[model samples]
Target: MVVDEQFRLHPESTAYLDAVRGMGRSVNTERNYAYGLALYLTWCDERAFSWSDPGFENLLRLRNWLVSTPLPVRGRRVQPVIRYRKDG
Candidate 1:
């Protein structure tokens, strides 16, 4: 069920999800893949890179960005939350 900001199905990602489901991958695993793909796609869009063929160097840059950037908070915070913690 991966889609873009336009709410259209990303055909390739949807196909990939279908394949993994056929192979008996768990729902949680599929969910993780979907979100990761979405994140990568969004990064590509923001940086004006072609998601289908971002160069290796750009991908390496993305790896660096992943560690350097603080992830967005998941929901409205009722209390103080630590920044950049992988888990809390």
Candidate 2:
């Protein structure tokens, strides 16, 4: 339930954030979501995406960014260092 100083809620983000929180996420999890989403939006800044636009390449780039992020654990950097995997 963290809100920015301007108090504007991003409509597209609420449902996903709530779903993750409902799964018993902690404060750190919330922070991660916020950080990741902020970066994602920044990446999308000059690009408007839609089915009628320049295909789905931007969507894949966002997915790639998520896949490359590593989660910290007990002072160790673990392998398979990604949030999600693409099915082959």
Candidate 3:
């Protein structure tokens, strides 16, 4: 389920995930969707847009930001994943 930094369950996200799960999606699918929702909500929060109803322009901006920005480097203790990004 999606959660904030404080570790509380996100109500809307949890409900959505539950619905998807009830439809027979796998736990892996739930995890992936949860991650994506967290990213979208966090982006909306940073830009002071209402997460549920960000406007079309705001959504376009989010799309642009996602393509332009590099993904974060994630690592395990034994190995790290390296991603290369191209700049416009």
Candidate 4:
């Protein structure tokens, strides 16, 4: 498991990732999940929300934030910024 100094994942989150790896998940998939969960944790921390116990209303707020916020795309070339859009 890679240790990131900037963001420390909760023990349960680490164990979950390890389990996913033990299940033969691809490295790309594991990495993607780790990155995504890390981002969510960071967001929760910033908003003083408990990651393990964010209430339904808090989850809705998170959804709203995610939908409105622009996310950066990573690549070798110029990365585009995108936001999550909810489809009705």
- Candidate number with greatest TM-score: 1
lDDT by residue for model 1 (6-78), tens: 7888888889988989999999999989888888888998999899999999988888888777866777888
Candidate 1, residue 60: how far the Cα is off, in Å = 1.6
- TM-scores of all models? 0.77, 0.47, 0.76, 0.76
lDDT of 4 by residue, 1-88 (tens): 3335755547878998999999999999999899878878878888887889999999888888877876666566565656465622
TM-score of 2: 0.47
Regions more than 4 Å wrong, model 4: 1-9, 76-88
Candidate 3 minimal-lDDT segment of 10 residues: 79-88
Candidate 2 wrongly placed segments (more than 4 Å): 1-7, 50-55, 60-88
Clashes of 4: 0
Q: Decide which is better by lDDT, 3 or 4.
A: 3
In angstroms, the error of model 2 at 23 is 1.1
TM-score of 1: 0.77
What's the residue-level lDDT of 49 in candidate 2?
48
**lDDT (tens digit, per residue) of candidate 2 on 1-88:** 3235687776666677888888999979977897777666555654654322434777777677656754433445654444444433
Worst 10 residues of 1 by lDDT: 79-88
Whole-model lDDT per candidate: 0.82, 0.62, 0.82, 0.79
lDDT score for candidate 3 against the true structure: 0.82
